[model samples]
Target chain A: MRILVCVKRVPAPGAKINITADGRAVDTAHLGFTTSPHEECAVEEAVQIAEAHGGEVTVLTLGPAEAEEQLRYAASVGAHSLVLVPIEEVDWDPQRTAAALTATISGIEAAEGAFDLLLFGNESADAGGFQVGVRVAHALGRPIVNGIKGIDVGDGSVTARREIDGGFEVYEVPTPAVLGVKEGINLPRYPTMKGRLASKKAALVTIEQSTEAGGQLRERLHRPVEQVSETVILGEGPEAAAAVVDVLEELGVLA
Target chain B: MTMLVLCDHDRGTLADASLEALTFGRDLAAAAGVSCEAVVIGKGAEGAVGQLAAYGAAVVHLASHDVLTDFGPEAWGETLAQLVASCGASVVTACGTDRGNEVLAQLAARLDEPFVANCREVDPSGDTWSLTRVQWGGSLLEDATLTADHKIVSVAHHVVEAAPASEPAAGTVAAFSPDLDASLARTVVTDRVVLSRGITLSTAPVVVGGGRGVGSAEAFAPLEELAAELGGVVGCSRAVTNNGWRPHSDQVGQTGTRIAPQVYIASGISGAIQHWVGAMASKHILAINTDREANIVTRADWAVIADLHKVIPAITEEIRRRRG
Candidate 1:
């Protein structure tokens, strides 16, 4: 029941996001870094799965050396192992990221036995390309499903649930499969004092990998014009209640 | 040198997002000095060919197979990959819906090409095409470039309005069947569990959303009643779902359903960034919160500074009173 969870470090944006002067990237000077929200859930899911199944959970990430913070965060949450695929560049397109991950995963699987499951965030918080997980799964020759919210381990099979408009769709994929898990799958746990201490001593494995950039290149970033609308205060409390109903009626919702 | 638009449908009816994709593809193709064709896959896809042409598909390619009865990412990706080669398409595009993005991802994997998702604008003017895509839903935007010989992209949902040509094209319909292996079925949809019958959060014209101030699971009754009175559905924030006061399907946020309701009545919700991304797409937002400085109140089109418990019932009563 060994598992691997992949995560990405992204800027923790506040109420307003500011872009860099050149418009090439987020202005991170004032912002701190944290694991993507979905991947935080991914790490939590992996740890819980390992705890219940009596196995180990390994957390992997491909980013700058600073990504070690994210890996340590995973370790603080009961992950047994950590691997960092350090990239020198500020960003790698989805294709190169997937290729590097595929090669690293192959090497790990060859050394250690194949992990029963591999988990990735449905999409990265920054790029949101929605391709790396699928590409990596294809390269590794494993079945993959995206936008999964629930997972249950069965006899040599993993049942994943994905939510749609009015319902949910389920898939029963065999072990050694891949899943792109979204947030809300589970509420990630905070790091405890003991867990934080252990994380400091946890062994960090760094893999040096280089690959060609993909066809897509980032030219620059530009913020869309803000649509400013002045809020009209109809009334206070139940006094303004009539105005609210009038607005709803005007919108034709109160039919 | 043809641009290929992948049409998405629910077996019988075409998705509005796909028509939007066709509209986007038509413009991109014209800019690239080529024709815009469409590819429809899976069951009941043939029935959508004419409708696609009405939206300006120059040629419609239908790929139907027994195994393609349900949505399988691998199979659809493989089919699109084959179509890209057969049609000699210079660019492939789809709506950035869950299925659309997933299928294009699979195609990118098979062909080892770059695929961009949630793009609001694309300029295929020169060798390096500039793209503006949404990140963190629509809270932030990224301007990037695509330097691929064969570009694959999925337009962000609802970014462009779906428009029909002044004169519908008499597009030709062609059939296609790719050589799909049995292994691709491993991740196919096996079963479906429908929780609600109708008026889902995404499709509901009006949505009544609750938050932490709503208190408990039982407290949602007022919100539900308000939604029912408005002929809409009830939605909630991630905090409400995290508190177990509402189901995940009813949650509105970045990780939850991205809704575009005509008006979203958000009560007691201090809007967080995650929740803002999902609710921002709504045409109009009315926030009811005790805190005037709350994010939802500050950003909403209309605000009522009051306790939702009293204001909700009064609004419902007002609507009922006026009708009587």
Candidate 2:
């Protein structure tokens, strides 16, 4: 029942996102850093599964040294262990990141034991390559399902549910499988006072990995054209109700 | 070398997003001085070859196998990898739908190459191609470069409008069979559970979204009724889903379904960043919230500063009265 959750640290974008002067990255001076939303939920899901099944939850992250914050956050929320695959660069291409993660996971499993489940965010909030988890699963020779919202552990099998347009698709993969979990899987818990204290004292395990760049490289980062809309106040409260209908009719929604 | 566009279809009907991918692949092929072709996998793909040529595909490769009767990411990727080699394709592209991205990712893993998803623009001028891709579900854009000898990409859904050539190419259809192991079927789709039929949240022209302000699960009745009257479906913010007022499938946000409805009627939603990302793609947004300064109100095209409980029924009544 052991689970490993992979997370990524990304800039916590606000109402408006500002790009760096050179158009190469986000302007992080004013913004804070947090685990990607989906991965945060993935960590929560891992912790919940471990808590219920009587096993340990290991949280792993690949990013700069500052990514330790995300790992500690996972520990504060009941993760039993933490592993940081520290990368010196701002970001690693998906191929290299997957390779590094596959290597790290292999080493961990070899030393300890194979985790029953490996969970990753459906895609990173920042880069959103949507390849790392699939690549890693292939490299590790495991069946993988992406965009999973619900997971049920059965006898040596995992039933994963993914929501489609009108309904959901189900897949059953054997244990020692991989799943890319989405955000709505669970609501992440906040760190308690005792948990925060434990997190502060928790030892952060760092893994040094150097990998070559993948074929895809970040040339620069640029902001999309801002969509500015001037809100036209129809009316106040129930009184504005008629105007709302008028707008809908004008938009042909009522046709 | 040819540029290959992977046509996404259900049985025989082609998806609009796949045509968009063909359009993109055609442009990239032109830039690289190569012919633009398309590859369709699985059952009923042979029927889509003509349509692929209408979008400028000169050659259509139909890769149908017994094991690939349904969508299997690994099998499709493996098939595309073989087609890339057999057809001498320098670049492979697909529409960035859920399946398209998944298949291309598998192909990238199988070939040990780079694959970019949600690309809005691609320039295949030289060995190194620069592209702009969406991040955070199109909330942000990233400029990146691909230097792979065989470039694999997925055009962001709805970024490029699909257009047919003035004169159709009358493309020839060819069949391809890849050697796929039975092991790839391990993760294939086993069962599909249709929750509700007809228009879904993604395809609904009008979406009525409820938020935490709706108070309880029962409070969504009004939103549902209004959506029904408009011949659409109901959506909700993550907060509503987190509160257990609605299911996760009905949630609209960064992690939820990214909708492109004609108009989104978001009621009682404060419009957090996550929710805004999903709803932003809608053609028009009408925010109904008490707080005028709420993020949804400020960003929406139209705002009604009112309690949704009072406004929703009133609007429904107004619409009914107008029809009568």
In order, how many clashes per candidate? Answer: 0, 0
- Candidate 2 at A73: error in angstroms? 2.1
Task: State iRMS for model 1.
Answer: 1.5
Off by over 4 Å in 1: none
**i-RMS values of the candidates, in order?**
1.5, 1.6
Question: Which TM-score values does chain B get in all models?
Answer: 0.97, 0.96
Candidate 2, residues A83-161, lDDT tens digits: the string is: 9998878889999999999999999999999999999999998888998999999999898988888888887989998
* Clash list (residue pairs), candidate 2: none
- lDDT per prediction? 0.89, 0.88
Candidate 2 lDDT by residue in tens digits, B234-268: 99988888787898889898888888999999999
lDDT by residue for model 1 over A1-255, one digit each (tens)?
Answer: 989999999988756677889888888999999998889999999888888888999999999999999999999999999999998877898999999999999999999989999999999877788989999999999989999999998879999999887888999898889999988798889899999999999999999888889888877766677787899888788988889988887888876
Assess candidate 2 and give its TM-score to the true structure. 0.95
Q: What digit string (tens of lDDT, one per residue) describes model 1 on residues B1-324? A: 788899888766899899999999888888988889998888777778788988999898989776787887888898899989988888999999988999999998988889999899888888888888998778888888888888999999989889997778777988888778887788888999988888889999999999999999999998888899888898999888878788777889887888999999999899987788889889999999999989898889999999999999999888889989
In model 1, state the lDDT of residue B9: 82
